[model samples]
Target: MLPLALAPLRRLFLGLALLLPAAGCSSGGGSGADDAVEAANAQNAQKIGAADVTEKQEADARFLVKATSNALLEVELGKLAQARATAPAVRAHGAALLQSRLDLLAALRALADAKKLAIPPALGEDEQEAYHEVSAQTGSQLDKHLMALLVKTQNQDEDAFDDMKDDAYDGDIRGLAAKYYQPIKAQLDAAEEAADAAEKLP
Candidate 1:
């Protein structure tokens, strides 16, 4: 009876010893699975952040270009109205500058389409037609504006030029240009900061 009881105890000890390593392996496997999941999640987060930064950079560039173009156009239009001396070359150059603006607008539209962004409300049918016509023209409108101003300045008729300047720039045009430029510049700066922040994260 004593031997039989001792045999049962020995068998029980052997069985427990075998199960110990398997239990340890299971715990290690669970830890490995957890580590893998964490690494995958981290990788996904990084990709998402990078994509956001890229998108922001593109948008900022677009806004900057638009603001700059609009400002230049306003200045040109002011000069055109004020110039007392009108030459064919001056008009041609002015037309060319206007055309450049159109080209820029077209490019913007194409980019927006590619990115699935909305078309600007200000871009109307006439604007599009004007842009196309400008692209087709040979001369630079910017040069024309400058030449006209130079001719007027050479004449030294300050009073006439001054009066034209007043007529050219109404309160409404200047105000609108400033309003658009300022807000877009602010947005661009913020987008840049956001991109920098994304780079820092993780």
Candidate 2:
């Protein structure tokens, strides 16, 4: 039982208690548990975003390595052809190839850096073995082997460039592929012509 004088004060306090939850609802309901859950969800989303970025970087790095390694192999073999070729025509062709590869390599490295990709200086295992095999030969024998190697290598380059031009996600890589496609195709044709002629030589 309440005293008569305190009864009105008690009723006013009860009315205010009823309105407190409604006021909290109007103010967007900042419960501590709700805040904790939201914070946890935001943290998870951030982690997922970071993972996506890392995965993309890794994928771009792999593609850059694949494309650039093959180009580097050709450049190495062209250097060998320059030193070991008996025919002046074949030596000249090797010089042109070396220049083309150097130009493309510079462009690729710059583009890869901008795109967060890492490339290797050494060729992969099988290619390194192929390089060693070519390096063992001398003179006209080297010329024949180098010309055949160039024919096969340039054919591979032509196809890879075409595929990259179609599939590349980066604007610069796509542009580079588009820019180099015709040159690579021309090299393939030249290599084939040289290989055929070399095959006829004694």
Candidate 3:
């Protein structure tokens, strides 16, 4: 026999009593959904970081492959130029390329080792075909084309290295790029001069 107003007040008090345990669970020893969500976010962040490192390693590996391909092509082309070019400067440039190969290979290998990356041992098919085409030529046939190829390839490499030097994800690769850029620039200059000289030849 409660009063009409007393009935709603009793119901309201009962509802509050029922809600108290839930409020305590949130504030007390229970690890609520907030903690679970935060933990999940932390784990996801860790996964993302790991994924980023994997991507960076892959890019560094690609860099090594490209460098090795260019180096091998340069060495092979240099030998052909040395043997067949009629121009003395082209032959000397070929000799210089061959000499530079040793230093370049060592530097590339060191970078690969430091990064735990495997260096590719051979050139791609297009480059091998280009190598054979150059190898089959002799005298003036080899001179201008070889010089042109040198200018093209060396300039392309310089361009790539310039673009990559600052953006390398690995600090070591960045350092290597910075260190090598100057030498590659010098090489590119020589290749340009050789190309210009060949064009000027009588």
Candidate 4:
């Protein structure tokens, strides 16, 4: 009974009319979902805020992490030197260094526990690479490689400890740094001597 254009208009209106009730019926559920999402966002924000650490705390934590890894590397290298080095000077230096590094690591672990900082349980990528490189050599080659690596690493470690001793914001971290700086310096000297000895070897 309707005109063609008017029939299409009627169908369009009927479809909208059908959709309107469905939209209205779903509005409450949509609002509830939005509220749940908002609440979850608020809770996450609160949790993040609660877990946030201060900048100084973060610095101290980072130092502890690096120090732990360095100590582990030194310990492993020291063991390797004792087991694989051909020179008496290298082996004796390794033994002394190993004992000192073990003591340092023990102290560092205690301090890290007190600060609630997490330390990695093994060597970092660069440290592993250095270890593997030194391990690949034999006899005098191993001694040469080990001494060179020790000189480089000990210098780096000494510098780090010196900086931390002078500049650390945390009192405990400063104390640890001060405690180790002299020993680290001594180790660096020993490493240099070992390198010299290795160089003189035939």
For residues 1-202, what per-residue lDDT tens digits would candidate 3 score against the true structure? Answer: 5555335423433434333322111111223332322332233233333332445445555676677667877887788777777778888888998888768888987876543344544555556667777777666767877888777778777876786688776666778888888888899898877777777765
Evaluated at residue 177, the lDDT of candidate 4 is 97
Give the alpha carbon lDDT tens digit for every residue of 1-202 in model 4. 5555334333433333333221111111234333322332233233223444345444565677667767878898899989989999899999999999999889987975554344555565556767888999998999999999888878878988998897776677889999999989988998899889998888
What TM-score quantifies how close candidate 1 is to the native fold? Answer: 0.26
- If the candidates were sorted by their lDDT against the true structure, best first, what order would they fall in? 4, 3, 2, 1
Give the runs in model 2 whose Cα sits over 4 Å from its true position. Answer: 1-50, 53-61
Give the Å error, residue 36, model 2: 47
3 versus 4: better TM-score goes to: 4
Off by over 4 Å in 4: 1-55
1-202 per-residue lDDT for model 2 (tens digits):
6655434433533433333321111112244333322332233233323432334323334456656766788899889878878777778788889999989888877875554334544465556667777778776778888888788778878987887677664555668888999998998887877777667667
Predicted structure 4, TM vs. truth: 0.72
Model 1, stretches more than 4 Å misplaced?
1-51, 54-85, 118-120, 123-202
Name the better of 3 and 4 by lDDT.
Answer: 4
TM-scores of the models, in the given order?
0.26, 0.68, 0.69, 0.72
Per-residue error for 29 in candidate 1, Å, reads 68
Candidate achieving the largest TM-score? 4
Q: After superposition, how far is residue 180 of candidate 1 from its true place, in Å?
A: 23
